[model samples]
Target: MTLKIPLENSSFNLDVSGIAGFFGGEESFAAMSSVHLVRGRRWLGWYNSPGSYYVAKKYGVLAKSRVWDGLYPGVNVDPTTMLELDGKVGPRYVAAHSGTRMEKTGHLAYLLASHYSDLEVDQVIPGPSAKSEAHITIASLEEFKEFEGYPKLPADHLSPFDPIATVPIAFSVGASVMCAIFGDWYCFAMIILGVVCNGVSCFVIGSGVLKIKQPNPSPHSPPGDGVLFNAPGSRVILLKGSEKIISSITRGRFFLEYKSQSQYHDIGYSSVALTMQFLLQLFIVPQGQLFGQIMFLSSLGVSWIFNAYLASVDREDLQKRILMRVLLQKPTFRTVALPKWTSLVVFAAVYLQAKPEGTRGLLEQLIPNDTAVWRLVKSAVVEAVERNKDPSEVVAERNLDHLDNQERGLLEDMMKQASIGYNAGNDFKL
Candidate 1:
């Protein structure tokens, strides 16, 4: 009597639009499977052949249709001989001879048949074998299905601020501000105390936030009982356990140390800003002079703005590093692009702030003379500057290249410095 097994129907249907884009186009999508609709292509071709349908119905739990293409080329092996062949022939040879391409049904049948026939089937599966190496058995099909989804993505969370550490730091900042306003010698003492507390808090918070701990594997069990075969040649066995643990731990340690140092620099810069503000208010602003007061306030505002800019730049640098790491690990669906509107706004601001020669040079390098956006920004800035200046102070057209050589040389030096900085090592110093 031929034994028959029922096919498990899928609870979820494939997202056709998403799948179509993923494979390149509708034609590529249609080429995926033999089944085609009048309007759209079928996701899986299992229904095209009775044998394929039967195998998919019976062993769908072993793999999903989307992932079947990857598995189909390597499904002919008897599980019992997989390890032996793998050790002698090497992985490339074993993978090459595993099966014929596009044989979805045959692959499913091979997987199901191998699982039932071989007692040590778990040891010889083509995919990940770390848990199997550790003698970890799936308690149910549900547990195995959990591991079969799309690749696990990294978490999006990035900030490492700890509220507990932040509270004390906030208190220190407040105390330092109060002391500075009163012009007390105790302000120096408070500043010193705040710096020390800032360092300790940053280290403690960063370590907690980025901690990495690996789970200990189960102790070895007797062979042929609960144990899977101990194949030292398996990639997972050699690299997944202790090696992964060590690497993660090292990475976490380095991140924490780096973040702590950045925080220290941030605190030191804030201290400098506070000192400048205090000195300006206490000694530079004369009691009766409006100009002295305006100058003092301007200096204080500029110092604070510079400090804030440095902190923001550091954060952006860190975010870029994180994004690079993530992209290295996963396939990206689209290239990142800067919005045109943002570019325009930033260009307008830069042009308004820059010296005319410097602005003109930047425009020459950044945009063609005929570009509409550049023209708009340049005309607006030039009109505003001319409107504010006295007619007598307005420079003649001949001085349009004012400080031309010096500004161009300065701009080139700045560009060179930026290029060097970007190409330098990832280590960011304040």
Candidate 2:
């Protein structure tokens, strides 16, 4: 005999709105499960199969439908995955699953049946009621307090006074002012050199400096409060470990400062050499001599070698190595060790090329000091003038008499062609 049950029964309804979007269409949602409005509050949840309702009911966790909108309930949603619960339903509420929110039963039974089997279902128990616990809507459970809004991006930093850039600019402007006052191209070259050097140095050095250091978490500071740095590749900030940071920062300062000083030295050397060349051309060097030009240009070359030697010293900075890795855009090997053993060879070469060989004055180094030979040449020229003969011809006959026949013939031919060309140029001018 079948026992007749009353219309009023222990039941609840579970809404499956959250999982509705996942279905391809209403047919898919309807095919998955059926939801019907029963007469009383009954268990309403999605099930994998038609028989899952009996399994859930046997474990005391109800999946059987109660009522929805006071209509006969039918299968409409299946047990997919429980997302979360929404607003309250009547006076009592049950745990949600497969994006299902049930009302009436106040315990989490769907989570148990899904997670644990019948043997382990006893271990599962209900947690604090949703109404009893405080709620927080946060993006992340970790570090919830610190996140206020969208994080601010790091800003580009610029020093109030950069000696490397400022010094060169000052010199260039000074040269411009001097050019305006003195009205000479020498000053213009000086100014142009300064400006060019400044631009080049900025490109090379400033590029490295411009990449800002990312905020690294400090060991000493509270978690989430990152370590700060004054500039990219700089360790001016005293981090937790003092000894290491100090040494690293000192080395970085030395490397960048050494570079700046070397550039300044180049600018000063060029400016001074140009100024001296200008003065010598006006008062001492009657014409630009090939030997004089060679010696002067060689000195500048040696100065460049000296600058290279100064820069070649290995000064390692930890901060700079990290910055280099970031700028490369991918993980790379650590800073390659500089071959400092070759520094001795560079030093010797620089010294040999730059050092003066003998007790030669500055002017004598550039110009020949053969006073007696010049005087003899002058006497030969005077005798030729008195005898009404060409000075060049007389000089060659007297001073160059020891030359062989072939050498004499070659010299005479060169002189004849040079004289003819000079005459032609003079005629053209006239």
Candidate 3:
């Protein structure tokens, strides 16, 4: 059987028959065969035959296998025997297998659509096209929306304010003012501490803001009660308890909550208190007063610990959401401001504190390794390390191919649209 997936300008024909040897009646045959086929295709690695086996079994194929023999290392298998199973399977097995394969293909299409362009999958029903052979029809975004569970195309919402990037510039100006006014080591140290606190605070606060902006329903609030207001203040989607909205919001919420926090209300309180205390010291206290300095430093320390604890708790919350989303075969996305400032600050911090060159080791030491925030920081370090290596070594390590002309064009178009929307939003703000 062949699957025809529609793209922006053309269609992609997936020759399932070409990979028929990868699927067989026996669990071992299916598992090993698929691993071999997708060994180097890291993006497609998750769709290996063993994963398909469970999917097929769920649809009532090979119901007798109770023990879950997970994916195995690739090995040579009899191609002819696998082909025989594909061709000679009984009607029940054939139907189950077809359903399973189509489901997997649908998932693949969804992933591609999310990053590249909107796409849809439809089984070619018998009629005029029956003579053409069984195939999957890729539908346009408009056409795809008719199907169940498929979401609306992401809105061109302007990305969020980058507190991280802006805060550092603000801090530098403030530091210069202190240097001119106080001209002491204590003032210099306070400047450093303030910048560090602001950077870390901005990172977690930006993540929390993005989480709130995500097109997810509030767990505590009922459907229709939750409103998703996008960045740049252009779009608002009122959510309802309907399957479509709930499913989309639930998937999105699960991920957002996992990477950040379920709700940021408590964190907001802490931030407000810290900000107020800092302002009090800045405006009212004498510059040389040790008591005011102590109070400010103590508050900063407490805020750092509080934010770190929240970040760690958010990581645990995310793990639970991930398990739920995986089992449900659903995830979601939303377009919000890019939070460029936050990203810049976080990246700067990560770069300074990465292993072997711990210029700002305090940040690393403060953040727990187990937290999601730290994991992101680690990934950034690894990416930077990879870029510094030989070009050939980096290419080999990633094994990623350059996008073709068609894909490149589509991606460029998507980015351009986003850029235009962002600029427009900024203009409105100005």
Candidate 4:
């Protein structure tokens, strides 16, 4: 967590232990972290995580290095290290850091192994001698490259380019340039298409991510029966189609409904800005329509700035932002929503201007509320805590089916209070 970047004589230690400590779970996993030092001021970091057992079994990793082996004892991890380096001692064992992507990636894997392998060795091996050895594995560049060449995907790897982050920005910028060359219609069309595409993508992806799959009926399988997963070293496993499985895919999907709703808000604001540009062209005599277009485009830049801030924020700060947006808190929500609502006025004006009906009310028609997604996640978590059951087991056991009518009503009331659209009055504390 303490990254000591090389500096002439003394290395500068950037303390990121606080950030590292934020990521807590019961079991260990394969993690690769990279920190990029930019201009001695800005530090950019990326973290890639994969399930421990998946990587271990795929690559023949030692069981002593995998803590999850307790659940799947049948998995075979070779006792011998893949390859050993000349200097493997602790005090003098410094990882080789390099500018090359392959070296940087290899070093990250090495660090994770060095840190977590000891814990696994102690937990899985159950002997003093296993702990004394205290070994780790580092994949060679050739072995790493082999992963990229694999025929099947879902491989344990990371790439320099992230399409999910890049594609939308590229589309926005490209459309903006086109709009500047053409006319207001291009800007109008971009926002309209973006709203439609983004909304559909959110719904389809959210449905898949949040859906809870129940276990098949079996006399032997008791309540909360399913496949075991991370943390607490419990035998209870997650059901095949459980919402918890979304964690394995991506943590980014957790609050996707909120993110999509925020995107709708963004589109609404953009629509209003476009409407103003149109109004300047139509109504005001000797109007500075060119200035209006520039102003409209500037809004996109400002939105990107807001996005950058969101990206840099830690979990607690993010939660606060979500609460502010969802609860419609003070000037924050007022400031954002007012302009978006102005889009309705713009739509009225656009109708007189002979423009096609805009996508103003499309969002409400598409996503009335994400109440169902919230209900599923809340019910599973509460059941797990109340019954001292694994969340996956709760999902497999038919998602709170055992709850009596009275208990269900209580849970429903709690959910109403906790739901996103719920008004948080003086008494309610986030």
**TM-scores for all candidates?**
0.18, 0.17, 0.21, 0.19
- Cα displacement (angstroms), candidate 2, residue 260, comes to 24
Q: lDDT of all predictions, in order shown?
A: 0.25, 0.24, 0.27, 0.26
RMSD of 1: 37.6
lDDT of 1 by residue, 1-430 (tens): 5322111133332221111111222221122211110111121111111011122211222222334324233343321122111112111101011111111112111222233222333322111222222111111111011111112212343333222323333444454444444443333342333244323322222221221122232234111101011222211100111222212211211111224242233323322333333333333223213322222233223323322332233332333333234322211111111112223222222323334443343333333445433354444433333344311122222243544675546433333322222222112111
Model 1 alpha-carbon drift over 4 Å, by segment: 1-280, 303-317, 326-430
Candidate 4 lDDT (Cα, whole model)?
Answer: 0.26
Report the error of model 3 at residue 309, Å: 30
What ranges in model 4 sit over 4 Å off?
1-209, 222-293, 306-430
User: Which 10-residue span in candidate 1 carries the lowest summed lDDT?
Assistant: 90-99
Q: Give the Cα error of residue 428 in candidate 2, in Å.
A: 98
lDDT of 4 at 315: 27
| Ten contiguous residues minimizing lDDT sum, candidate 4 | 32-41
Candidate 4 per-residue lDDT over residues 1-430, each given as its tens digit: 5333123133333222122111221111111101110111111111111121232222222222233234234544221111111112211111111101111112112222233232322112122122322111111111011122222221122123333334334545554544444444533343333323322322222221111111233333222111111111111111112122211111111121223232233323322332333333233312223332333344334333433443343422322232222211211101001011112222111211211111112212211334554345345434443444443455556766766787677555434322211111111211
Q: Is candidate 2 or candidate 3 better by TM-score?
A: 3
Which pairs clash (backbone N, Cα, C closer than 3 Å) in model 3? 159-336, 159-337, 159-338, 160-337, 160-338, 162-341, 165-341, 258-318
